[model samples]
Target: MTDLNARHAIVTGGGSGIGLAIARSLAGAGADVTITGRTLSRLEEAAAGDPRLHPLAMDVTDESSVADGIAGAVAARGPMAICVANAGVAEGRNLLKTDLTFWRHIMATNLDGAFLTIRESLRSMAALDYGRVIAVSSIAGVRGLKGAPAYSASKHGVIGLIRALSEDFLGKPVTFNAICPAYVDTDIVTRNVNAIRDRAGVTDEEALQMMVSQNRHKRLIDASEVGAAALWLCDPASGSVNGQTIEIAGGQAA
Candidate 1:
């Protein structure tokens, strides 16, 4: 049996993309996973035909929703031993054109959402004395992304939060860490490409190439690559690997 056999995990934004991949990986490792998203239908569809994957409707931007939703999931499946705060928003806006609304929205989802998810998950994890808290940050977190100042700042905030929590819980059974990736092959990247094309009047190929070029390898990263990194963090030997940012940017030093 896998180390995660019979473990209970909570994955935010697990209905699709990198989040979904992580959920599936945990489930495959024998975890009973609860997947959350803003759209119940999408969550349901993603959970469809998989008994190990449970669907929960949640809007990470809403504190009340996160509290109630996570509480309900824990009540049903037991305390969450693994929490993946993978829900985030990525948008590229220059500082000159960015408004408060856009900045707040990004912060609320990427930074605040992670704070709430980790804070609430710790409640259950503390009781159990064993847990893993993993946040999906980005390459933007470690280095500045050329047109995405807000995104980079929010991601950097995520790593900061994780580092603080890790220090607070030093020597405890629970470990907190963040995974930073660059240009992963997800719908978010596709949307960003489209947005770039629209904003800069660039062709589709040009927009896509722009993102690929940002990566050290000059290619889109696979979602499974991140999933495997998450799996490693859950390993028994990884207990000491806390408060660190694991970067998957094709060898870019962060």
Candidate 2:
């Protein structure tokens, strides 16, 4: 573990799943981290697991909320030096069935939320001239998912944002990157399995298999896999890596 002592970090949607895993990894590396989510109770519960994890209720979709929430975290901890825009929503919907509200809902939480988090974190980190911005995008962001047009589009936007930000910070200490994981073993997969069972009238086992088959290796990725990847980007050795999308899809996302 690279000693992150005295470093300040932020992980959005850190209440559970991949976000929580990343938070824990950063804390274990010695960075003071604030985990934020829409629900205060969940955030508190997650924070209780580690002294380095502090709970902050912040709705990433809302601009003011993200600004104020990050500001509050800075006030309590310190200016964020590492930011993981890991909060996102994923759902499968046909283009025909994806209404405006559904499309906006997906974009707001995934793309817009990442934008806000990174924007605010930049204000703080740029002041110090050092930082790492990691966005938890998806393989869907890199390629198209069959049934989730809206979700895919939103994730694609996240990659675009990161790429653009990296260019904006060229020759600077800050680095912007995206992690595109195909199917991480997280609560999102469980929820997706239930949805698949309900919508397609498939057996629970069949529903589970459908997602497993999405990855070329025929296995779900562990949350820790993604966490370790995020932690590595924050390592000082990764300073030269910028404007890149790292894929963790077991194999090529096809």
**What are the Cα lDDT values of the candidates?**
0.92, 0.93
lDDT of 1 by residue, 39-143 (tens): 999999999988999999998999999999999999999998999999998888889999999999999999999999988888888887678999999988998
Per-model TM-score, in order, reads 0.97, 0.98
Q: What is the C-alpha RMSD of each candidate to the true structure, in Å?
A: 1.2, 0.9
Q: Count residue pairs with overlapping backbones in model 2.
A: 0
Give every collision pair in model 2.
Answer: none
How many backbone clashes does every candidate have? 0, 0
Q: Over 4 Å off in model 1, which ranges?
A: none
Q: 113, model 1: CA deviation in Å?
A: 0.3
- Which stretches of model 2 miss by more than 4 angstroms? none
Quick one: best TM-score, which candidate? 2
